[model samples]
Target: MTTIELTAEEMAFAGKIGFYRDYENKQRSNIADYDTKRFNLTSLQAHRLGVMCEVAVGKFLGLDMLKQPPEVWTGFVVSEHYEFNKGPDILNRFEVRRANVRTSPIPLRKKDLEYSAQVVQVYVPYTQTADGISVPTQCELLGWSDSVEDWPKAETPSWSKNGQARVVHNKRPMSDLEVMV
Candidate 1:
């Protein structure tokens, strides 16, 4: 049996900030031309933006099936000062000080596993809209592998000559964003 621990980190820099909201079915087509006013984002609001981005990407990559709700967690603190560009027009730029993954659990069978390693990831904010909506368009995941010298090695399974019975069960987590509306 082997145990594995995974970790991740995500960050966004030089991104534009704006206020945004979902468009109703009736107004979907007109959303692009709709007026989107900018506003100062609260600490919690900014944090949620990071979180939603993480969740969106995870769901896209099939990772949503791997973990429970709060599947991808995030903790963020906003920088004190907002960077505004004034040359052409006023633009708001706020930094999410430090946002990193706390824990990511990987479930696997204990047997047939030699050793496991930790996985770390970082996500950066890349795009923001005039509607105060932000999304992390860039993300990176790092996986480290190392040998466990002290643990006794288990015998390898021989599936070549012997007839074996195997049963596999797969389960997927329900999407959270789907129910938010």
Candidate 2:
């Protein structure tokens, strides 16, 4: 069984930080009707969060690398609310709710394949007022998805409040056109 541990610094630097943004996707027909403004984090944040998730999933799955070098740490999904420095004193609140470490298959140019491991995480954030200021009091990680697109589509696990679990399977067949043509 793998036993992964995180140093203080490692834990601090890793994990996804949610940010606010305006989403503009013409591909979605319904998107045009509603105000696009929403809180969203960057893809980089999401990827980092995935790493943090590994720490938890590794423990759950009992993988062997949890004790080795280049130690794998699962990703974290963090939901946070930050108030203007002048307006609020609370910085953030977060929780690691669900984590998963799993291997994904990748195709090689030589008609071979390899398995790459990744972590997924999900969480939520909430804020409330205290002492005349809004403060982040809760942040939760709900679950994880191996791929970016699959992340949202994945289901949360039963253990999580809104947890839905998702497993990715890469089974796309390779075309032979490039092998000879």
Candidate 3:
């Protein structure tokens, strides 16, 4: 497997973009807007991971992340009149999903299946410095899949605060994904 590592400069740049975008979301969201972000993460954390993963994938796809601004994924539309849009994660062609080295099923929320092309998986592993601060120094592009249409539908691994189970449109296995070059 090929390993992808971001440089110190890339790290700083990604963090800056993530912070500003997260801040923008907070400022723009009104009470009527319901946050669709899952996984118990604050909006800031999600934005950071989202940006870094997309950058890493772009690098894997032969793009210079530094020379280009990261594209923000506009998720499900909040307005009643507007329909959902295909939010591609990179180059308007792929959707990126965060995974781990151990491998697990890639879960896509029911509304997230509007992506136009392949579902690409990326695993970002962290390392601890001598000072004991954890930093991401390793990333792996596990695989890609366009056959999510055949994947099994299931409930989210987590339950809501009220104990209602949310649905995941595709819970596709990691091992089943096609290996990336």
TM per candidate comes to: 0.23, 0.25, 0.61
Indicate which candidate wins on TM-score. 3
Off by over 4 Å in 1: 1-41, 53-61, 65-119, 127-133, 136-138, 142-181
Residue-level lDDT for 154 in candidate 3: 42
lDDT of 2 by residue, 50-107 (tens): 3444343333334432242221221221112112221111111111222222233221
Instruction: Give the residue spans of candidate 2 off by over 4 A.
Output: 1-39, 62-121, 124-181
Error of 2 at 164 (Å): 18
State residue 74's C-alpha deviation in candidate 3, in Å.
9.1
The candidate maximizing lDDT is 3
RMSD of each: 20.4, 16.2, 6.6
True-structure RMSD for candidate 3: 6.6
lDDT against the true structure, each candidate = 0.26, 0.28, 0.56
